[model samples]
Target: MSFVHFSVLKDECLQFLTENAPSNSYFADLTFGGGGHSFAIMDLDESYKLVGVDQDPDALKNGAKLIAEKQLGERVELLSSNFSKFPKLIKEKDPEIEFQGILMDLGVSSHQFDIPERGFSFKYDAPLDMRMNYEDDTIETAADICNTRDADELEEIFKTYGEERFARRIAEKIVEERPIASTKDLENIIFHCYPRNMRFGKIHPATRCFQALRIAVNEELGVLTEVLPQLVELLKTGGRLVVISFHSLEDRIVKRAFKELGGKDSPFRILTKKPVTPSKNEIAANSRSRSAKLRVIERI
Candidate 1:
């Protein structure tokens, strides 16, 4: 399987992480989707050691192959787990390993959307399973949510996570048509929920609803909230933390977390007062990167 995610804000991440990094410094790629950023860092300096974690099986499989192919096996350790567990995992792996840089490219990976069976994209008529870690039975799938969650709960999820304006209408429709087995089925319901004149707009009406389902299925925002401080804790005194979030919800969390963690007496400092975005060229090259916003903070 081809994991085809274009790492967003690649150059910006590399520059910030490598700026004050010492020779043989350790780094962590918390969301190692395509291994693009990790590979770039290794290419930048042969001595830099990297530990990459991804809950998705495909990412880990591809990463292992790529790591061996690039002969980065010795320098790069690819762990198969969600980044939310990084703090504990790091301690178990190496009690003294403090990262010089920790990079988190949040939100759904391009590969996840491109793959039809993953049920991330409404473009395909696949099952409604949107679990980031397919093997995790603890978390409910998107279908489970639609099939079991009450109308009010679904409405809140759609409104809060996706910011969908017609969340209430859509949630009611979803409940009325329970057991929405496929992505296309959910997509159609969301489409008709919109006013006829606005139904065929530039963006698909189902986009936000699908996003809401994915977020809920994966508990993305909550997991991000849990991990941001842990990431800060694992950074070395002068280490940098770079995060690229593709949506406002995630960016807001990143912004608030940085502010909370950075202060005069605090051992951290915000590196980007305003979030950095991809250049026009980059956005043109990868349309999916258009919404990406990067923020960096340094451990003081």
Candidate 2:
């Protein structure tokens, strides 16, 4: 399948990032999944340049192709590092470099969930490999965690990352059914772990556990927390840092970090007192965007 990702809140993000922008400024899209947001920034103005970064090899490859096809090779520079390492990587390239606007659209990209072999969704019966950077052998796959971790540890991961109510039961059942090598295997275990009556709810029983495992496998929350302050520091004065988080945990972290960074004595100010959610029309058009929440902060 082609790399297709519907850029969530494109208008809102662009408004916050580019409105009243400085001349000849640079913008960074830290999670350049499909180059949707990155290319949008460049198309908005010829004077604006973009630095697109992503860890996923597939995304990086697709971004390069898109950049070339759009004749934006000169205006857009695509990097292959994870967003967490973006600060250090960009610093090494040019110590004085700072961005006019920086954006982070957190959570798994639509392409990741759609690819069966990538193992991001319960809908697929593929291997339980949930590493965002599939090339990074150092990161443990979801199968490894399911097959190895103790029930208690697994429970903690599901409970803390997924907010799963049946985490304990599911974790215990997973230990009983060790060697869960595939997504369907893990999904079945989680399904049976739930009460029979509750299994047919609107949301699948395996949703939370799958989400938890993906977050755990990728260390999404920790990376986000670690990178927020660095991104703030990399912002130019009057520049903005905009983030769109899909889950509550991610939103909480972004909210807290923005508050701390935008404190009275700080060199930043919170732009969105409350998060901005998608419009009714937007959610109707793209169901995946329903849960997204956007927040922005500007360096003073």
lDDT of each: 0.92, 0.93
Q: Residue by residue across 103-170, what tens digits does model 1's lDDT show?
A: 99998788888899999998999999999899888889999999999999999999999999999999
Residues 82-139 of candidate 2 have per-residue lDDT tens digits of: 7889999999999999899999999889999999999999998999999989999999
Separately for all candidates shown, the number of backbone clashes (residues 3 or more apart, or on different chains) is 0, 0
Which residue pairs of candidate 1 clash? none
Worst lDDT run of 10 residues, candidate 1, spans 1-10
Question: What count of clashes does model 1 give?
Answer: 0
Question: lDDT of candidate 2 vs native?
Answer: 0.93
